[model samples]
Target: MITAPGGRTLDLANLRCVFTLQGWTTSQWGSAVFKIYNLSDDTANAIQAGEFSSIQLIAGYQNNSGILFDGKIRYSSRSLENKTDQVVTIQAVDSHDAKVYATINQTLGKGYDAARVDAALMQTFEPYGVTRGRTAKMPGTKYPRSKAMFGRSTVYQDLLAKQCRFLWQFINGQYVSIFEDASLDDVIVLNGRTGLLGVPTQTIGGGAVIRCLINPTIQWRSLVQVELQSATTGYFIVNSINCQGDTMGDDWYMDLNCTAHNNLVDKPHKDSSKN
Candidate 1:
């Protein structure tokens, strides 16, 4: 079910839910790409570039559990391939909406703790509905200048390199929170039963691009165990997760990229206080 602006609800069963999925991770604004059969109604053609002020995408598992992707409707497109064939596709994003575009020019004269820096980042997004969770802190410089920035993605990535910590959004719907902690958590094991779809082709430097079932718990930058082989029997930090699934069908999956923690990743800067 999707709740659009003005409290108008569009029931999936009523609209013929085809297939769609949402993706959220660090440095990137969360997105929900929706494709639904539009023959039953004209909502598709009616929706404008920003028709829906706010929208929420809700899904459920077989057990009757629910997953929510609450964000602003950033874009919409209507298509009619044939006289009788029509479909509506909508793309929604978190508070990090590009529509409200602006460059960040904040200077922390004496930078705060790692957690404080995370809070500052969230502050830029707070007006748009972002929160903090499982924050990590490290001793670091007091001054970091981010001038004439374009978006949040680059700064967050730069912080990851500089602070020796990771920052990202782990979705659980409106309950979604950001991770700024160095010691990550919420480890979910991936295997034959836990939705490990197929063989995870491991790569050099202990990185692997793997696929698995659509599990909401599979957060970005979190830890996971992949029993791909006896030699690869260990934990891997989820570098990224692309969640693609159908709200109406059982065709759901997650394409994940992970890296070993001790993969010799270089830190962008040494703690100013330490030096």
Candidate 2:
């Protein structure tokens, strides 16, 4: 679905769309690419003219459908295919990407703790349209006087995550941080009945790579229960997901890279103020 100018929603049957949504558990920004075909001239012009603001990709069966990608359009272009069909391709990044390179130059006073610093940062990001989502408990580290924060916001976020021994990323439009070994409560069960495509394969690092029919319930940092072969049956933490789908093609599926839950080892904690 696309939100064009004037708040109009576009989802025509003649419009064919293929998208790739990539997610990661690190501080890197998640991104999406959408190729829409057979759009009307007006719609194509609107998109190419930078009149479209946001796009959403939803998948799964009727009652189980959910958002697969939601982001602001960063670029759009129109091209002719076979000299007959007009296609528009859009590239987008999650909300956090908009502010990843934003500069932050603030000074904290003495006795400011981790919680207070986090709150101040969130307040700064609010004006940029990023809201705080679930975040792990920050370490109990207090800053001394003249704690200067400078440079890109993402760099600070990465430093903070490393200091706390956690991972942080943006999903949809919200910022989230979580411990490496912790998992979301909602566990998606994957099996023959639930659209598991083939036997999962193990990576050299003991992680698993799997493919399945598009399921929106599967997301980054979430847990999935593999119920196929005995050797591969266990809970896994999703590290990354690549969702590929085409309305007019047989390419609707999700490829996930996951680590076995039991194989995850928490990193040793470090002093937050050392950096």
lDDT of 2 by residue, 3-51 (tens): 8657878775456888888877587677899888878888888888887
Give the lowest summed-lDDT range of ten residues in model 1: 266-275
Q: What is the lDDT of residue 69 in candidate 2?
A: 78
Model 1: lDDT equals: 0.56
* lDDT over C-alpha atoms for residue 39 of model 2: 85
Q: Give all TM-scores, in the order shown.
A: 0.70, 0.87
Query: What are the root-mean-square deviations of the candidates from the true structure over C-alphas?
Result: 6.2, 4.5
